[model samples]
Target: MQMMEYYFGLISVVAQSSENVLFLVKPILPIMLRIIAPVLGVVVIAAFAGNVMQVGLRFSTKPIQPDFSKINPNPVRFITKMLFSRQSVMNLGKSVFKIATISVVAFFLVKKDLFWIMKTMDMGVLQAFQLCLLLAFKLIMVVSGLLLILAIPDYFFQRREHTESLKMTRQELKEERKLLEGDPLLRARMRERQKSYAKRRMIQEVPKADVVITNPVHFAVALKYEPLRMGAPECVAKGQDLIAQRIKKIAEENDVSVVENKPLARELYKRVDIGDEVPEDLFTAVAEIIAFVYKLKQKEAVNV
Candidate 1:
């Protein structure tokens, strides 16, 4: 049997060793995924929130794969960027400020407990040291306050870094968008159809407006009044740019009054909604417009 084992020694395997276990660990990619999963999840959620809060997301691929080949390695750039610029200066200032504050607090606390310290000294050296510990506690409290202040900038910088790191290259952005949106031509055509439909609806509604108020040529707000439903006139529509000019043209074609009360027009557009009552603040302003429209209607009735 011994001779057989020597010849077939390969048939027996030694138990797994730490080195073997570590080798197994190194090859397993999922182990690294499991470790970083929580961090990735946090980053995704934070990036989403940051996108919403910041400039409403103009997606770019520039941040994702930035070129650092031309990175400045000059002494000024290195010193300023590495740890001595705006953020670092703020940090250093904060640290010195906190130390000073804590020191002042500790000094006051030590003086306040001086009587206790004296009494404790008469009792024993240990009790006197305990009295001095009161100052330490006050210092801790002041230091904690300073830390809260310091954490504000740290949180902002973390979000800023996250934003910078997420930047992508132009090609990366196009590829990612292609993957997500599919057939760019078809997507653009769909958008044009939607815009055309909205335009048709706007054209149809412009004729029914009681008054079309214009900022001469920039802004247009259309109002409609229903005595049974609305306590006062409500804005049916408000548009700017090409839509505003279109509204004015349609108002002229439909014989609807194109009022020039810029302030009243602005107020109606700002404070009122479609099919809602005009605000109390605008009551006087809108009442005057209504009176003018009514008189114009009375005169037209006589002419007919």
Candidate 2:
């Protein structure tokens, strides 16, 4: 059983390898390195191409490498799986095809019975070995071709298995959607809570603001300037949507007057970040608003 297994394993490897090597056959000849370089180069290229087809060019630690013994062993379970499992069906079918091809081919060579093969002349051992080597290489190519045919179906099955394994289920889709967008009711509650939180933070910082900009009904921003941190106006608080309404309400409560300008409000929201300066392009419009707000504070102070 062990001898049978060892021989089977050897044949299986030869059959598989032959497929890849057959691709190197050139009616075409390159003048230089001939068989050696071209064969190695093609093997590397084909392996690379095959790998890319499987994973679309990414790197990871996953592979379908099976335990060495399970591939072909004297053991009954290994043999059973190889012959009875679906994988067995595929493998056996491939093997039978490859074996028939190799048998037919080897028979031709055997009948040619070129006594030259057995003729180990008094010629140097090196000369004799050179003859054997050529014959062996020829044999290898024939086997490789057979293996490649088998590998075609094997590659198809492997790809199908890989894709099926990685395909997402409906439940996975739903879970991913939930993660991206929280439940609508939950989202609504979060927005309200965030609005209230913003209002409190805005009011606490309102009196210290250099200016407050608004769309009157919908948007609001508060900017602060400090000489030491002194280069530009910084948004101390900014808000939109329902939160924009809340910010306007908070500004009113804190005696921070609001100015309504649709363009200015939209521009600030798009270009400025909280605690960051309004861009230079908006300087004229923003400065004009800041001056107006400052005048309002002075007028209120005078009235008081």
Candidate 3:
């Protein structure tokens, strides 16, 4: 065979002159590199592309992070899982099927070219190498095509299995919703209780007011003032509609003066809030009302 003759010639050259050995090897080195480089490049590219196809271009370092759970405490359970787990079983089945199919295909392919393969024994080294390279290229192409067909179904099956595994029961869904959003009924009840407490506090403030100003029917603003203790007249309580009616009733029961000033009541209700000082712009109007209330109280005291 040409291969045998080539090796024998190299041996003779090595024996004749060790310096000539480099000359013979120099040409072969480039040929070997040329033959191997494309296959290696293809393998590296295919591995990168396969990962990109599966999970896109996203990158994560989580897989390399130290995990206590990975340290199995039970050897028997770990061994059983490795041997009989669904993923492991599927992997083993796929490997066996691939090997059987490729072997059968390779066997048939070689048998078809048996005569041509045998004739390579009489051919030159380069011719025989070319023939083998062509056969290998065909074999790889067939194997890659077959695997591609198998991968389509495998992809869908894995996706369906993942979806099934992630499904939650009604109780689990409810718990997850509660964890994320809180209980709506409990929130509503708390809001109702808060409103009731605020109303009670506002009613209490009405009795402490020196005078309650009313818009006759719709609005009420209760103000308190003490020249020695406070800076200016402050709205102690304020409300509209039913709350305004309640404020008037509380003022009457407590003997606090109730002054009907439609414009003052509406302005105070709009511009000021409970516990806030009355604005300076309405000082003249408020002072007039306060003096009038004080005169009426003085007359009542004198009568008593």
- Which candidate number has the best TM-score? 3
Q: Could you say which candidate leads in lDDT? A: 3
Candidate 1 per-residue C-alpha lDDT over 1-304 given as tens digits, one digit per residue, 9 for 90 to 100? 3333332342245346887656555545575588679978986996687557654657778777879875776978887786877767867886787678667867886787777766864754444555555666666667767666755676676678668768987998998999898779989999999988876876788899888877766778887777897787777777777888888998899989888877776666676655567788887777788778879988999999
- Which tens-of-lDDT digit does each residue in 1-304 have in candidate 2? 3433444345546645566445333322452256579788988998899788766888755566655653554578766765698766866777787788788888787556467676857644556666777877787787788777767877888889778768888988878877899777898999999978866776677656766688766677887767597576788888777867777776677766677888898889878977688788887787787778778879989999
- Order of models, best TM-score first: 3, 2, 1
Enumerate residue pairs that collide in model 2.
Answer: 18-144, 19-144, 19-148
Model 1 TM-score on a 0 to 1 scale: 0.38
Against the true structure, candidate 2 reaches a TM-score of 0.43
lDDT of 2: 0.73
Candidate 3 positional error at 32, Å: 20
Please report the TM-score between candidate 3 and the true structure.
0.52
**What number of clashing residue pairs does each candidate have, in the order they appear?**
8, 3, 0
Instruction: Report the Cα lDDT for residue 61, model 2.
Output: 57
* Candidate 2 segments whose C-alpha is farther than 4 A from its true place: 1-86, 98-207
**Model 1 weakest 10-residue run by lDDT:** 2-11
Worst 10 residues of 2 by lDDT: 23-32
